[model samples]
Target: LAPQPKAPPSPPAPQALELPPNASPVLSSGPSPPPAPKASQPPPSGPSPPTAPKAAPPPPPPSKSGGPLPPPPALPGSSKTRPPPLMKSGNKTDTDEDSSEAKTKLKPFFWDKVATNANKSMVWDHLKAGSFQLSEDAIETLFGCNADKKSGDAKKDIASKEAAQVVRILDPKKAQNLAISLKALSVSAEEVSCAVKEGNELPSDLIQTLIRWVPSTDEELRLRLYTGELSQLGPAEQFLKAIFDIPYIYERLDALLFMAGLPEETSNVKQSFATLEMACEELKNSRLFLKLLEAVLKTGNRMNVGTFRGGAQAFKLDTLLKLSDVKGTDGKITLLHFVVQEMIHSEGVRSARAAKEQTGSVSSVDNNDLIEEEYKQLGLQAVSSLGDELQNVRNAAILDADQLAMSVASVVHRLGKTKEFLNTSMKSLDEDSGFHRKLVHFVEQSQTDVTFLLEEEKKIRSLVKSTVDYFHGRTGKDEGLRLFVVVRDFLAMLDKVCNEVKEASKVTPKKTKTEFPHTQVFSRSPA
Candidate 1:
């Protein structure tokens, strides 16, 4: 019996990174096709060395043979095809072969096109297995050079081996171009991020950089870092716990927007879903947001103060209010609106707190130039963005507040329209079918929730007051009382509206169902 050649060892297991569902199936580090063995300075008559086998050519297109077919839409991954490999200066014989065989030369653009359309998994697996030099050369010539090869001094590299070289360039611009040629390509920095513990293979320097980046205080970097860090976290409760423990405004904001579904932008569009997952993890961490949400869930409290900006001692008024703005069960949007409103209102409170915190303590304030310079860095006018930024958080917080409030308001307005639709009461269950009665019940419950949300949003700032507006640093009590009276009267009007709605719905007969007035008010419909 003939002896069989031993198969190379299987590739190493994939690292522990949580790859996306559509991540490439190809594994790297397989046996590469070795470079051709050279006999130095061969004469023209000497025999050429045997070349390695080229990859399997693709099947001819059925659509092309039959008739005109629509071009495929651009792939979702990046459009960057890899740049061509540099023609090595040392290989003179390579140039001679190309100059000699201009008649039979394959267009370099053909290889470029193949590189863009080929499956990345196929290329990744082939290069990873072994010494892939020959394949790499083929790939480089194909992707890097052009169809008008005879015009350029392209050293006449052989057409057969261009696929492999295209796979190895790590630069994103080059990589992105190379990726455009393949079936699907993704460009991600290989960051070794970990909150705790370390892994192997990755150099220690890379690991350290990742650690420093993971806990960034800067909202921009933290928001960017949150995506990579959360991917390392895997799908478990513990991973979320670790992220929330760290405090940064962008981290918190990203988490909030993500958990709410309208994820904020940071990286490439392909990774937006990853952004959403991280957002969910962030919402899990916000104690203030979560606690207030629990209260809303319990009493359906719309007018609750939500979380305070600088705690309750900051509020001059004595009570919270309740209101509803939508017909949904969960009050996420309404709650966000209130939270933003409070954040906006609380800026003055926080500024007051900043002043009060420094009241008794004496520090040098003579360095106005130094303070103004610092404010410039924070991008502010007059006052140190620092003083206000203890609220601009570099404008990230304010921007988030604006975005979150807008989204919530859009949703709340949608609920208001649905309320208008079901204005008439339902007929008796006996007259209509049981299904009709169930429908009415669902609408009634939804309307109550909506009413509650509207009420809650309307009343968000009802009890909030600046602890120090103008002071000894003590402001006058009559002024405080005067402010409280204005709020008291407004709350009474809101309560009256709520009571009137409940009464009208109770005694009213069933009306015909109509189209929701605001059309999209049901955006976050019920679930």
Candidate 2:
């Protein structure tokens, strides 16, 4: 701490007076002075006679207590004269001194005492407990004047108030202690430099933690201008000052952290792109999925026969999710259920034909039992597996295009910053300097990797846009990500329908055959 200026001396106490034996009793000290003597009446009508001068009074002796005597009381009589007021020794008046004494007598605030004794952890513990509240005056005295100016609200919670005070005051030791308690690394700047030069990676967590505790501009300036012994400063200040010797320290740390994470980030982005590609392929090429959509279109056209919606050629993918909302006359089976049933019968018939062709068998079955049993088994197997066939679409549905783009952008931005540091801040370094050489190589390699990533990102984004357009017909600006979501939801409804169909097939008697009256509206063609 800097040395504080000394306070001025207090004025001496007033002492008791020792009056002479012949002195009048009224001359004793009192709050008010006595009246002064009036002039003698002028001698009547003639030249005044010269009067002899009276002898001067003798000096009064000092009191036995060996202190100066108080001023004598005024003589009786003419006009009263008041004594001069006591002079103040400094800017502080007597009342100010009394207040200072009172403050000194009061117990110190808990945090203030903790700071003085260097029990920083205890201070934090007490603060975290939040068992005590501080007055505005206590905050000013403990931290500094106007510490609350940042918040402007006096009703802020204790933790925030104390944190704001600590930040504003710039107590290096306290900051360092808090950092250490919070698991900051104890390694010195030279250790870090040596580690980097030796081609060894620093702990990723260590770099992350230290990056947060980097000194602010004002703190850095204060450290640079400090004229005191380095030993006198706290470890935080010393470490910060030492790191100042390493050019582009912050940039280097940031680059190292970025490089450490780049591989995983790139892998994630690649996986997302792959999922998107698979989702698009599944939507465009899955035969059974296309057939299911054809059935939906035929059904919808039949329902809207007399309206303007009749004979519609296509519909948005989002309508697939709404099939469950249209219930049958029985109020149990949904339109999705109807579609699943039709697809099942179609798949079962096709499978039966394929099986018949492969086996070259022709078995005659007059009874409906054999026919119903045979087709039901094949249809349920085909419809139940649709969810598994479009697994990539399910995965892709959870992804956000903008978030992925931002992640790639973040990597590129960090690489750009690293490159800028290498070019600008390390210009003075010789070509042979290990620090400069290593960082330059890192930046160059990173830029190359990021360039590849940017190209991949652009390619994937374009693919996603084209895929959205293929399905949705020119999606809104924000609709690229929504395509997979809509499909994913439709797939969920399809799964529910498949489950219901399988359950229904099990319960229905072999004698009873399931019929689709709605299928009569469309031609019995492949779609």
Candidate 3:
């Protein structure tokens, strides 16, 4: 069988062009290569002038021994047309009349392009566009800052540069510190990710610092921070632990989500399901849910549907659904709140209709009385909403000890971080906030009262203790500590409310210095 079939010949391999060490491009003698067509130049025409071969230009002056090519001199008839005249420039060299120089000059070096004495607003605009281009030394000099701002370099280094440029040139460590200390953002504040090249933690203390800076105190920020910290927290569990203790609901929400190993919202259906559910919870919170009511009311300025039941969680659409049902339980509160205003409005209309009828001015305080009633109802419902939220979370997930410790640490961390805790508006100086602050001071000063229930070897009575226990049971120390932060927040809110109650009886002694705007609508009728 082997002898019967002759061996098949192999096909030849394709040859490749390999240049030798001393090889140069081979030129064809048949005809000189058509001179490279000039960009935007007309082609040559007419009979050939001569058949003699033209000599190639000498190999470009051997590249000046190690420098770039000396540009070729203009050949007699190389281009039919003369080049355009160049402008005289103070910073440019004048070339020969026949030189084939490009009209535009070489760009100045990077240094020449800097804004040494640029206006702050001009630089600010550039920075806003992410175009910072200055060196650190240049930046410092321009801003009139030195390394020590009691005269520090930071104050001096405020030069114009692209955001990316400054971030790129600085020592990552120093840059990160400056970024935090300045309260300015090159991009979004959170995008200033400190380079963690060699260590486990960010040397600038970004996590701990942001934990302190996150603008939250009410259910709002506490709630948002809980969610914000979830995605960006990295493998540095200890740093995360430090921030995890922040006393905010949102921060705790972040802790719980991560502790339960809830994957972030992604294209994956499973992860999306979890994120959407929490978002849904937020939408139902009284503040957010109330917007829907406000939206419906605004169409008619304010509306009145008497003797019906309603709630913070109930949508107006739901109320409409219940309109035909047996006695609406809370619709009556909505009615009573809006009824006076609406009745006055109706009276105004009727008075107008009769032309001769007279109507008295509707006092603004009529709306205000209803507003105070709404405030009490709203506060109660808000506090109740939190209680329900905690219940829902506890029912939904169990956290590990590491996660719990992380959460508690974030809270305890922020408590010591700031010299003062003031809401970020001009109204922070109002009477209502003064009493509020005093109350907080009272609670914070009395650690015993704060921890009175911790003395219990028996039932863990306080919200903080219970929250910690819940985390400790499964998650471990870190996350449990974080949960404790949430517990403290809940307790703090409880204290604030209790203090406000005490304040309501006393005249203005218990008022907060901060003044939030008051509503003019009632949330519920008094029992």
Q: lDDT of all the models against the reference?
A: 0.33, 0.69, 0.35
Q: Number of clashing pairs, model 3?
A: 83
**Candidate with best TM-score:** 2
Compared with the true structure, what per-residue lDDT tens digits does model 1 show for residues 271-362? 32233233333333443333333333332333334744322222332222433344235544343333322222223233433454579645
Task: Arrange candidates, best lDDT first.
Answer: 2, 3, 1
Cα shift from native, residue 38, model 2 (Å): 62
Q: For candidate 2, which ten residues in a row score worst on lDDT?
A: 30-39
Ordered by TM-score, highest first, the candidates read 2, 3, 1
What are the RMSD figures for all models against the true structure?
Answer: 40.2, 18.4, 29.1
* Candidate 2 global CA lDDT score: 0.69
lDDT, residue 458, candidate 1: 40
Q: Please list the residue runs of candidate 2 whose C-alpha ends up more than 4 Å from where it truly belongs after superposition.
A: 1-178, 181-190, 196-199, 225-235, 362-370, 431-433, 475-478, 514-518, 523-527
- Clash totals in order: 56, 2, 83
